[model samples]
Target: MPPETPANFWGDMPEEEYYTSQGVKNTQSYFETPNGKLFTQSFLPLNQTVKATVYMTHGYGSDTGWLFQKICINFATWGYAVFAADLLGHGRSDGLRCYLGDMETIAGSSLSFFLHIRNSEPYKTLPAFLFGESMGGATAMLMYFQSPPDAWTGLIFSAPLFVMPENMKPSKVRLFMYGMLFGIADTWAAMPDNKMVGKAIKDPEKLKIIASNPRRYTGKPRVGTMRELARVCQYIQDSFEKVTAPFLTVHGTSDGVTCPTSSKLLYEKAASEDKCLKIYDGMYHSLIQGEPDENANLVLKDMREWIDERVERYGSKNL
Candidate 1:
């Protein structure tokens, strides 16, 4: 079924169609990994010099397609070479849908793809940034920790799940039950009612489009996936002080999924001398895709200005 045309559609043309029409060079392929083949996408500017490279990842249950790709298209249009991969068990990637058993392995798979591109002759010298939204924000941090210092030129995060919101946190009883049943039914969908799809997005029309995404995982959070998510969020929260890369994190003040306090804590705790945090008043979790057109553009403008400044300061040195 076609997505219901929302009364509040943000773009004149559908986002994907608009991006293609704007002459962005978009490509989709799979990156071979030891565990499975990961679906990857790249968006590059057409007939323009690539100023910087952004390796990004989608939030939990989301992929590099649909509205998420709109940000990639915007980045490409602004002269960034954007690369992203669907994490294991998400989208077109080979794994159980939304079942992230071992986050380390999943993070490694994403980093491998980014490293492959970053090391290539054409992009080796470009200033590279790591971008992640929601849970992928934790994945980006994990990737940074796994890599040597200064590997990435900068980092960008949008409502990263460093700390799961209090209401969304799993109860002790649930965790105990998961522990008891994990070995036998680790893939079981444990939290069916925890769907944040409707809550995280503010616009009814945008919510309809997101819900209609063919690649989105609408099932309950798998047992192992939830466990790993808890563990990863805890790990990131504890390790915030270790971050040293220049980073800009933006969060909506009203986000109900991932707490806005997480970004605040990160800014206060992170060792990065150049780190920044922007809190959008009353915006929801989906800062760029779910907000109204004016609000989305407001966030995008901040992103563009930050990225362009970095490119101006650092890009020419590489060239």
Candidate 2:
């Protein structure tokens, strides 16, 4: 469903750039979707001229800026302008704290953004590609499912979540706990020690940034959010064969947060004949953020090659 005008959506806060050195240009704008809800967005222009634009979405509990700076820098360096946004309720976007329940609505915001830009003068005809990480990857795929074939030139997913690892708890105990806790309190109750995607972050610098940012890395996932995440995982598991768009997915075997199995499942089941999956041997959940320099470089190398192949075959321009 299309939203009413998103006139109420807010833009990024003042200090987003203080947290990372990637130096995003900070267009710091909001587009009015329908329903008086506004969508938060940022555009980072590449220094070099470009043939395509990349629109990126970050993972759960992560803002677009927190997760996409490195990739944006790389894409910019490679001559592709990058556009990124916080999903509703994630970064600077409007809504409750982490309250996006439906993936379709989240996806629609991008479609709105794309249409809004496509109709504008500067970006009228530029080919745009979609990129997402983790839940953001799932959001991209969900959007692709809703969009027409020309909706995007192609897609790139990093650690896409077909199924995320919930916890190390035993199934019976975990379910019982969920049932008991959910039965008594609201079903949206957040568990302890479970929201720490950044707690054990290997990078001290990144952790400091996360710690410093009050708007980020501080959301408690509701039970509804957890349930929706599970539902989307199951949906992906059941409908991978329907995903026909050419996509490249990258994941790490050692990723304990989102789990590498999800990537394996997507690779094995996705219907796209042009799909490719590259698994990093020892990387963690955030492959681009957590991997060693060489492995991260290789991962980016694979993504670059794939993008080149798509642009060459598709012959689309970056906005």
Candidate 3:
């Protein structure tokens, strides 16, 4: 953020005013999961007919608030009801900050709230999609795998962590050393700090804004977090062929965090005949939020078109 920027990413305007100015209604609440309480937010168009429902998940160390909601607000403005939650160990939710010991349990906690809203009135009948970015991409896929058949109409992934880039991958030797501790070092923040924010973001100004998020975890990757991600990422890649839902996976060729190759793998391996993949020539990992307005808008446009067609093809229960 610039020196003149307010504590809030959107400036001194009240949150409601800020969201209203963005042409969306924003509501915040606490969701009780079997594991713990989660800070949740829902965004919806004020006067437009709801087209479809989208359950979104934010990247690691990021919450549903802050600059992350840029994606949610954009979707809501496009007539989709967007719902997101801070993961179990991140943001204002319970547990140690950014400590993801068990990927399955963490995914389950967030999926609980999503299923509740998805099955509830007004939204249950509507076509629904799962959206995720960065590490959340893997989490969202896990939710999809665990979800009942036909529970989701489609899937969307942005710079998913299905394949780990050389530099971003945690050291196998280090993880093995930690593993020798027998669950002792699982929560320790001793893993290498990859300076991911610097790499994942392309715009310097947006980097400052994302770095300013008070809820963002800036510490070194936790021992268990990296270990589990390594394991689960492979698990996700192995399950790619089982993905039968219509889906769109996008990646920026220049992304320094997650590799675009993994996204291509999903497109190549997935069983969905309707699956689509778009590889942007020179975008960053945070395609929708970290890129310049023009670039971000381009990505959003593709997303809008893809989703509108999916809703039309599948038919929304709302209609």
Candidate 4:
């Protein structure tokens, strides 16, 4: 059974009480990477045997703090060690705010962090999994492609940006113009009408908390950032069949940011023999964070079951 919240707690428990109830040891710090210094947080089970390790990455303009940390806490309670890194330009990481200059550099920085933990003492022998949410999903997939086949035990994606939804996609003319203007003012914010936070989160209170996050980037998308995102999406789609790792992807049917068709396409085209896809009927993009309590719990239940089964079936004997 999962940890129970204290009676005094209301909508959300205090950080100390929450971590104590979950029996998790939490830590946060900054680490240097080739691209820039990155911030990372980890949640490890206390007085319990860890069954697996999950290296996570947050979505665009988001970080390891705020609602994203909630999922890490749950994983720790379930006997899994969770480590998450703030992508460059998000959270406390050093960079231009929400500006993704190059996909390769961004993905490479995460891969380096993950590999460090995977190859470290104690964790070196544990079965490892990659968990990516939203744009982080693209980086996770790219990391998988960059790694050898047996490097990770499994991959998990939540509302992955495999394909940008029609509503959220930028105009082709704008993209062309941006590409030409890349030589100058590449860092200028271009696409400003990003109402994704409103569309993605269903709970009004949680939406407020997310919106109030000081580190959250509410500015328009940058020219170089938008261009790179488009290129990355196209590359992932073209290389879907190249994904041979056992994996599972979950997306909400009502998601307005990333299309559900992306996960469907991955399921149909991926070469992985052991792969699964789950679509929550009316849920929004923020599966475990933005939904009502009941719906969020349901998504969390599915994710836990899927991950637990894999850990049991493929015990931490091989990498």
| Maximum-TM-score candidate | 3
The TM-scores, one per candidate, come to 0.93, 0.80, 0.97, 0.93
Report model 1's TM-score to 2 decimal places. 0.93
Give the CA lDDT, 0 to 100, for residue 11 in model 1.
39
The clash count of every prediction, one per candidate, is 0, 15, 2, 0
Compute the lDDT of residue 67 as modeled in candidate 2. Answer: 41
C-alpha lDDT of residue 75 in model 4: 89
Which of the predicted structures, 3 or 4, would earn the higher lDDT when compared with the native?
3
What stretches of model 4 exceed 4 Å from their correct place? Answer: 1-18
Model 4 lDDT per residue over 51-95, tens place? 889999999989888789888988898999999999988989889
For each candidate, the alpha-carbon lDDT, in order, equals: 0.87, 0.68, 0.91, 0.87
Model 1 residue 9 CA deviation in Å: 11
* Model 2, span 192-222: residue lDDT tens: 4464565325465555544454456464565
**Which 10-residue window in model 2 sums to the lowest lDDT?**
4-13
Q: Please give, for residues 141-247, the per-residue lDDT of candidate 3 as tens digits.
A: 99998898889999999888898788878898998899999999999999988888888888899988999887889899999998899899899989999999999
Error of 3 at 255 (Å): 0.5
The deviation in Å at residue 46 for candidate 2 is 4.8
